[model samples]
Target: MSYQHYRLEELARLVQGELVGQADLCLQGLASLELAEPQHIAFVNADKYVEQAKVSKAGALIVTPELQQQLDTHQNFIVVANPYLAFAILTHVFERKHTQTGIESTAQIHPSAIISESAYIGHYVVVGENCVVGDKTIIQSHSKIDDFVEIGKECFIDSHVTITGEAKIADRVRIHANTVIGSEGFGFAPYQGKWHRIAQLGSVQIGNDVRIGSNCSIDRGALDDTILEHGVIIDNLVQIAHNVKVGANTAIAAKCGIAGSTIIGKNCILAGACGVSGHLSIADNVTLTGMSMVTKSISEPGTYSSGTGALPNAQWKRAVIRFRQLADVPLTQLQKRLDHMQTQIESLESTLKLRK
Candidate 1:
């Protein structure tokens, strides 16, 4: 009951929508059409949900002009171009404001580090020497910022997150809990029958408006920087190996792993559990379906799916048996059979032409 309240007209103005019906009606929060109460606002995206929106017991509804003409009911409405987008805009209006308590007593910030007065350092957060924390940035409890790191303004560093070994995070970035930035990548040299450790000398450069989810590991480069460009959204449990460069506005789903030195272009979509091998370059506007494995470089932009789709157990068994049998055939014999078939097909085509 203590949440924010807005008039029907005010909510409409926020989303640049046209207001219809009662302007004085107070909307408390947003909800789905089926779950909306009298004080809540609901949104109907498509025409299919127009009936549900009409019957919803909500204070108001956010809808398109096309859907607005269909409703003859007395329910108040806020008409927008995109009802879903309007709902997204209004969510920030009802977001609860958390009070900043300044720097907590247990936070260990170095004297040489430039901590902004507007920033909030939570309990037991460790900030190393020569670090620069910009204004309004919140380093939550149990987080660690290593030496020479720079975090820009209005960034959110969640609890148990580690920004270490030359991490440079830009403005409005959100790194969720337990995520590690600038960790040493998997690089070694085999010398004299032993593996020699190769130091990761480079940093992680994350651009503005990047949102990294929980438990993700972004490894530092062996020489050059590992870059995540602006507006990149990374899901949880993702592993990005050394020197990998991900372009702007790319969305990588959960559990995807990209090996060393790969360059993924802008506006690409990598579905869940997709694995890309080392040193490959993926073109822009490409989409990889779930469980796709890429071993070579992709030069063209298109949706690519690799491996086999799920099938019935009996069908899958038969497919596996056929695949194994094909593997057992000698390469020279297979080529000879293919050549003979091609010659016979050509002869048949010639005979058909003569008869015509």
Candidate 2:
């Protein structure tokens, strides 16, 4: 994607940074230090990468004032308090160029559906009966909004996403491609010798500013709503089971599986590949490290981790043997202590009888 050039002074104003470069110099987009061209801008956050910044071919460099002396030339320095944050700001501006601004005529809208005129529906998209798509929302191609679904304003639903009927999605939400929302939960009962599937009658309620990555599966509740509160960011390939409640601003990384009826608290971070068991309550501000297994409820707000790192085969074998011996060691020590105490007690009793 191509972007129009923004002047150094304008960029500084936009990102709330201090200008140290020639204000008239234009920057089209952001680039890494090694790949930057004369039309691009780059940022250096640490002194360790200052050498790369000096050799970069960027027209402008966003850096801290302390690091400005390391630059090859003073002509392209855009000094800031935080160079990383400045880079994020510039990248966001550059990315906005690729966003769809208006609706396309090729979109398929059901006669019973209501889509705001301000919404942008991309090519070959389908909006089912009685569906309500709000203002400034963008539904990309090959995406399906199933019957009676309500999507709020400024939502971005990427291509090939499937949102089942009766699902409620709020404003500023972003859903990536091929994700299945509001699917039936896994619920079955054993009747005699056969399994009887339970009917899932509940829907999913996704709140504002939520971001769901590609290929994630969020199952609908069995009898109540499966809720994802505002600002929840879920990564790709994650599985969120039925009746799960993920609190506001909680971020769950890729490949995490949350079982049914789990309540994950606000501002929590569940790292990649972590598995959380069902019917548990995890408190706010908790951080579960990568590949950690959560089998119990956590009421405290802190970082909890499990699982061991890789080790050499010989050392690992020794560690496992020692672990097995741990149970025997305590029992042997207790027995020896008990025997010594009994001997001392018998001697005292004999001395007392002789004295009497």
Summed backbone clashes in each candidate are 0, 0
RMSD (CA, Å), each prediction: 1.8, 5.2
lDDT of 2 by residue, 289-348 (tens): 999999999999999999987799999999889888876688879799999999999999
lDDT of 1 by residue, 213-250 (tens): 99999999999999999999999999999999999999
Candidate 2's C-alpha runs over 4 A off are 69-72, 96-106, 317-356
Q: What's the C-alpha lDDT at position 237 in model 2?
A: 98
Per-model TM-score versus the true fold: 0.95, 0.87
| Number of residue pairs clashing in candidate 2, backbone atoms closer than 3 angstroms, sequence gap of 3 or more or interchain | 0
Worst 10 residues of 1 by lDDT: 93-102
